[model samples]
Each structure stands twice: as structure tokens, then as C-alpha cells.
Target: MSESSIAIPTVYGLRSSGNCYKVQLLLDLLDRPYHWVDTDSSAGATRTPEFLALNPNGKVPLLVLDDERRLAESNAILCYLAEGSSYLPADDWDRARTLQWLFFEQYSHEPYIAVARFVRRWLPEGHERQAEIPRLLERGGNALDVMEDHLGSECYFSGGAFGVADIALYAYTHCAADGGFDLSRWPRVGAWLERVRAQPRFSPMAA
Candidate 1:
């Protein structure tokens, strides 16, 4: 089909969670307009057969691109949209570093920092998941420590310039206190967060 005949892109996500916020932030940052579909996974919106067809994992932050093409995994969506932009590193090794931190953000950081924030902010009062808060706090702290060490040497997560690496990690890192992880201790990280915020067209994650 011709490009003009394609449907516009649309993104589906819950309000909370850095995973979802990453996509929203990138879309806002780039001015690559799209429709936003508010999906509440906790309310079973993600489990429906229709949503599963879009993403079998049943996770939020799924993107349906122009012409009905679908992309899942927020990082993948970021890369797809960022292909020709400054947000994507051009040098092979430098680009790899961005991917490395993006992976770390998902594997090591998101479970602790993002999950903890979800439990604290999204879960109802007196929820049993509160029992895991301490573990979440510890893991989140460790992630922040790694981030602090890295940011001490580089202005951005991947290196000198702000790229997908910064956006991928910054989504949750900025709101780490919601997960009970303190930012006061990580001065470098705090500075990095400020840098990301200062970028032209920088967008805050939806409330």
C-alpha cells in the first residue's frame, strides 16, 4: 500500500510503569504524532483476545504503526522510531553501548525500580505485594549505584550524547523515589536526569 493510504500509528499503554512511559516519552520527544490508547492491564484490558493478538505477552506499551504494522517491546519501538534521528547512535560500537544499557535497564533495573513503583503507586492500599517492597528497594538501589558510577564518567547513559539509552533508562530513574530509591545519594545520576530534562522537546511521562 502507498504510505499515504496507511493508517496512522497508535500506542497503547497504562499510565504507570517506565516501560509504557518510555514509548510515550519518545513519541512526545520526537513530535512523531500518534494515537494513544489507554490500556489498563490491571483491569484486564491487556488479557483480552484482541489485545493478545497485538502482543501475546499482554503487556502495555504496544505500538501499531502506520499501515497496521505492529511493534511490541518499548525499546524496540523506540529504536524503530529513532532510526534516522540523533536519538539513535550511528557509530557501530557507540550504538552497541546504547543497546547495552537499554538491555541493562530492562533486565537489571526495570524489575526493581519500575516494578516497585508500580506496586507502590498502582496497587491498592494494603496490597500483599507490599511485602516485597524491601527487596525491590535493595535491587533498585543497586541499579542506581551502577547508574551513578556510569554517569560519573559520561554525561549520558551511553556516553557523551543523549540517545535512546538516556530515554530508556530515564523514564523510571527520574521517578525512582516512588520506588523508595533515593536520588540524593547519586549526584551524577541527578545531574544526568537534569540534562535529559533540559533537552529540546523533552517530555515528561504521563501522570
Candidate 2:
């Protein structure tokens, strides 16, 4: 199909969400055209009946194809959009490595780091969630340590190349200070972030 005939995908997501920013970062890096529909998940927009009909999980960062088929989950959307691109490895072992890091980002990294950021940045001062920050910081620091160890030997997260897994982790890792993380503790990871930033067409997450 001609490029002009291809239908642009529409993304429904909150600009400030790390998960949503992952999708946007990958799209911009690939120079792919997409329409972004701002759906503020924090504002209860994702909970509306109309939004629920689109995704039963009631999450932002939903991807709607031209035919209206929808995809939920940030990493899933990344893998889908990265198919056949260098961003997704073609070699089985390399692709498996990429998937491994993607899993790690969601399971081992994001829950601690991203949630910490949310509680600290978005929650009202003295909100009960404030109580969770100490634990969150400790656990999130562990995740950063893991990334630091990995980066000590490797340059990128996706099987030795900058790819979707890097995008996945970078989404939250860059802004971890909002969660009270001291990036200086993870020097290699900090350097890796600079490399990710140097990639062509890189775009910073919205404020």
C-alpha cells in the first residue's frame, strides 16, 4: 500500500502518563503519523461509559486502528507498532531479550517507580498515600539498581540496540526524581538515558 493510503492510528492517552508517553515516543522516533486524543485517566475520563465501551480496563494509552480494533497495554502497543521495524529485533534470541526487558519494565520497574511518582506528584499534600512513599522509594531504588547493573555491561535494553524496551523503561526512569529517586545513585543508567535522548527524532515527555 502507498504510504499516503495508510490510515493513521489514533491513540487515546494522557500526556503525562509514562505508559502513554512510551507510545508517543516510539511513534515520534519512527516518524510515524498518529492522531492523539487526550484522555486524562487521572480525571476519571477513562472511567466514563463511552471510554469503558472502548476498553473494559478503563485505561488511557489505548490504541485504535483505522478499522476501530483497539489495543490496551502500553508494552503490547509498543510491540505491535514496532513490528517489522529495527525497533523490534528479527532474530529469535534478540527478540526474546527485548521481550524480557519489556516484561521487566512493567513488572519490576514501573509499579514501584511510576506509582511513586504518581503519589508524590499528583496526590494532595498530606494525602494518606503519602505514607506509601518511603516503601515505594526503597523498592523503586532496587529496580533502578537492577537497571544500573544491566547498563554496566550493555548500552541499550533491547538486545544491544536502542529499541522498544529502552523506550518502555525510559518513560518512567527519566522522571524518577519526581518520585524522590536520586538518579546519581545509578550512574550507568543515567548515562544510558543520555544515549536514549541522543537518538534521532527523540521527543521529551510533556510537562
Best by TM-score: 2
lDDT for position 195 in model 2? 98
- In candidate 2, what residue range of length 10 has the lowest lDDT sum? 1-10
Model 2 lDDT per residue over 1-207, tens place: 234332699999998999999999999999999999999877899999999999999997999888778999999999988888899999999999999999999998999999999998999999999999999999899999999998888999899999999999999999999999999989999999999999999999999
- The residue-level lDDT of candidate 2 at 8 comes to 95
Residue-pair clashes per candidate: 0, 0
TM-score of each: 0.92, 0.96
Model 2 bad stretches (over 4 Å): 1-6
Clashing residue pairs found in predicted model 1 = none
Worst 10 residues of 1 by lDDT: 1-10
How much lDDT does candidate 1 score? Answer: 0.85
Residue 80, model 2: Cα distance from true site in angstroms = 0.3
Model 1, runs deviating above 4 Å: 1-7
